[model samples]
Target: MTRHTVNASILLTDRPLLERPAAARAAGFDAVEFWWPWPQTATPSADQVDAFVAAIEDAGVQLTGLNFFAGDMPAGERGIVNNPARQDEFRANVDLVVEIGERLGCKHFNALYGLHADGIDEEAEAEAARANLSYAAKAVDAIGGTVLLEPVSGAEAYPLKKAADALAVIDSVGAGNIRLLADFYHLAVNGDDVAAVIAEHAQDFGHIQIADAPGRGAPGTGDLPLDTWIKAAQDGGYDGPIGLEYIAGEGDPFAWVQA
Candidate 1:
């Protein structure tokens, strides 16, 4: 049977941030993942981290994946890894992310590459990203974790919109722990042939997130063949949990999964 992990950040928005893990458990999922919870500051207070840890522990859910601190996601910032000014800020969060992972036994972390910033040359941005990714890789290595690079859609200025695009950066990083995050919704939104991508690069993926295309809703809400695509990923050797990162809208978000 296929295992699923809820994206607590997006899925259980009706509840408090610390309460989402329990909500996911109540929805019948045993595992969960999240984007950086503290969007405004990379370094959240010790009490804040403790509460997050307690939430997951109290919920009895496994934290399957996490994103390192990206900038204010609500404000449209994708990440800080590639920004020259925020390089230090990105670096500062690496250890904290790793510390959380160590406490939670979570091994997968996503690192979002920011859009091209003004006044910074392309070379400088690329260099900073590579250096930071390498640093994150090294830190996570201590905990035997993997750093994930995902291709996003809807943000035209945000680079790495394809599997190959992220793979090239992984190559440059040259860390075995660095791998691709195959978010099917984003890939399909960006006009990628999802089936072909699954067939050709399933082995390259470290994690998989899903939502239907066009609507970014539950699997049945759109035209994408999510079942077939998931089967393809499985056939191609993807053994990880599937992340439910969709917009639930009004009705039951997990109704499809239950059915």
Candidate 2:
């Protein structure tokens, strides 16, 4: 009896942003998650925020997770955490994301570690990331929320490419509220043993997102043993909703998981 959440940003792209929540609900999902809805603007207008909130509420879906304003995701920028020039923007986004999460009762926020900035040294970038992550962790602590650090693939510039990579950052930050977002598809693409990761680090997971390797498609569309991996995660104590953060094939995306 595991629950599932839709990554509306990727799953329901055929519809308008505000409409995706209802579309997901219509598709039989009770919960949804998103990369920041406004990609270009870190802090959007109040009206924009209200509208986003209303969409989820009107659709009667719980917002299970959200990513803190990662810069221009479509343009190859992973995040701004490691950028000194954009620190203010990242901090602004943190407050806004937390506010939205509090209104919707969402508890998980993914903070994508940005690509290395040209002028900054590796140690400098790492220090900046630690500071920003600590700030995000503290902001969410008041709401009993968790900050997530995920390992991503497909973007070579994105430094974190394995479970251990993200976990190391979590350890350095030393924040109890910060944890790992073990995205199985990304891990598999990066060549990590998904089964071993599940068995070894499920307890450190704050949330889990999934897609299939070779192609970020629906579970059955590729070769990853998602079902087996998920069961191992469950056995190791990860009881949160499984995030279907995949690209749909020709037909319904949820068809593979439907009862």
Candidate 3:
């Protein structure tokens, strides 16, 4: 049988990170992922990190992945993968996240490419992303964890809109510890064929997340052919958890899946 996990960011909507594990368990999620859990304004403090770890143990919910720092959250930066000025900070953040993952018994973390800079040479940007990813991959390997590089749609930090592009970056990094994170919503928005891409990137994909495209809501709430996509992933030999990373609509987000 296929297994699934919920992104705590979706279920715990307004709750603090420390409280999300229990909430996820109450909501019947066996495993959980989160956006980021660093020293940002939105994250819990050091003490809260300890408490969060305890909560996960008590709730018996596995911490599947934690997004690396989203880069100065108060300023609305998404991440640090492509930032030249913050390369060191980005590396440090990855180290910290790996530590957190180790402490929490998680093995995966997200590496979101930050916003693209206008007028920057495309080749230069790719090189920068590759270098940073290499560093992150080494760190992940050192800590016995894996990192997934997720591509965003709107801005072009790393234009990995297509599976080929994502795979190419992974190849450039040349590290087994770094892989692609296939998000159906982003793939659809970027006009990539989700199922075909999943099949093509089978060996290179580290994790999967899903949401309805138009509204970014629960799987069945929008036009995404989730069942077909899920089947394709299964056929592709993907046995990892498919994270429900979407927003809630009117009622219980899991209602449709439950039925």
Whole-model Cα lDDT of every candidate shown, in order: 0.93, 0.92, 0.77
For model 2, residues 1-259, the per-residue Cα lDDT tens digits are 8899999999888889999999999988899999999999999999999999999999999999999999998988999898877888999999999999999999999999999776679888898999999999999998999999999998888889999999999999999999999999999999998888888899999999999877899987888898999889999999999998988888777888863
Estimate the TM-score for candidate 2.
0.98
Model 1, span 145-241: residue lDDT tens: 9999999998998888988789899999899999899999999888788888899999988999999978899999999889999999999999999
Deviating ranges (above 4 Å) for candidate 1: none
TM-score per prediction, in order, is: 0.98, 0.98, 0.90
lDDT of 3: 0.77
Could you tell me which 10 consecutive residues in candidate 1 have the lowest summed lDDT? 83-92
- Put down candidate 3 lDDT per residue, 1-259, tens digits, no spaces: 6677888866666777667778778877789888875536334467866776787788888999888876765566767677676777777777767777888788888888777677877677777778888887787777688889887675554456666677777787788888789988988988887878877776567898888979888876779998888778877777788998888877676786778
Instruction: Kindly report which residue pairs in candidate 2 clash with one another.
Output: none
